[model samples]
Target: MGDGSLRRIAALARQDARLLARDPAPLIVRTLMPLLVMGFTQPLFRAALRAGDVPDANGAEQGVPGMAVVFLFLLVNVVGFAMFREHGWHTWDRLRAGPARSFELVAGHVLVALAAALAQLAVVLGVGGALSGLRVRGSWPALAVVGVPLALCVVMAGMALVALCRSISQLTVAANLLALLLAGLGGALTPLSVLPDWARPLAPGVPSYWAMRGFSTVVLDGGGVVDVLLPAAVLCGFAAGLTVVTLVFFRSAHPKLTWS
Candidate 1:
């Protein structure tokens, strides 16, 4: 809040952005990998559709949105991994030792993750537009409003993971496992309608599900801006709650640095 804190946050953001730009692997994986998967899987799903295997409702209409959700998951995972690596290598310690506060650290990492998420979103949208001929039917501004909070949720989730993890390997394994589970439950790999009745209740609990539904409703379902309000609010709450939890976890883990 103070000028010093604001300057520190700005510095950290600039440093993180430079590091992210220098490393192209995570960028490629986060932005392009999902597009590739969608490209390859579209034909398989189409064939399944023709053969009456995957069901018609689970075809392009549902699949495209679901794939976009998966791409978002990839973006979250990449950011999580990058954060884990930086924390493991003591980069976070160095930053904290500098002018950066805990909030600044979180903000900087979230900013970097947001950049990656936006790039990933653009790639998915481009690919979906070109290949699947997908179109956004609702208001673009509303979609953008919904997307910003969702990306923050993802970044906070990554921070929570970094705070909870003791080692890089553990962080990597946990991140991947959680990403896979959330993606599956959130209709990334399959449509929510195709899920069992008992599983219906669980979808709303996963962050990715809200993100996917919010985006699809605004972009593909021609829904009103009000329709996305609940999901966007939920994602914002998720981000805020997880941020508090991450801060507490970090404080507990590094008691010596509590006042640093």
Candidate 2:
């Protein structure tokens, strides 16, 4: 909107970034855990491919990209805690008392989360490729198209959680459940084709499902940017819809009470 508001959001985002960097738990959970999971699964994926059992996946490619989708849920939970962290530290009022509006504060969290999610996804893919000998076999930019939307969706969803839940525990429980349920139903835990008949139709509805499909199109099919455009558009829609919902929820909420 206004230049002042833009400046404010940027400054606040920087502050939020500092706070996030200082937090070790989010670092371990968001950054390290996904890499660890991918590393552990690489051997299994390699074996499956050799046996001609893991359909549509060649060695570490499937398992590695798969981890990116799975960790998105975890990223949402980690980013969603930003509001609670401020609330716990009793800094929300201070921000609100100054030039910051609730939107400003929420936007800052969104910015930080967005950047973090993108970086986190890259780390997972990078570690998979470097340490586990994973290959892209397709356009790197195409993969980024999938990643951008996934990151946006997580950030928007996390901001919504900040508005909806009152306490860190409440937010954590709800976000984790949501992340896990989406992962389970959306083919992050397994392939969509392998899912039961009844679940097939529903799998397409989840954001992560689109992410997996897009990734597979690029990595497994050796498809290009044009092929991934559909899933990229789908993910963008999810991000936009979640953004609207987050705005509405955060706007209607009185931050002082919501934070409490």
Most TM-score-accurate candidate: 2
lDDT of 2 at 29: 74
Segments in model 2 whose C-alpha atoms lie over 4 Å from true places: 43-58, 251-260
- Candidate 1 lDDT tens digits, 138-191: 876677667778777777777787777666566667777888888888867765
What is the model-wide C-alpha lDDT for candidate 2? 0.77
Each candidate: what lDDT? 0.70, 0.77
**Cα deviation of 145, candidate 2, in Å:** 0.9
- Cα deviation in Å at residue 241, candidate 2? 0.9
Candidate 1 regions with alpha-carbon error over 4 angstroms: 43-58, 87-92, 252-260
RMSD of 1: 4.3
Model 1, position 184: C-alpha lDDT score:
83
Best by lDDT: 2
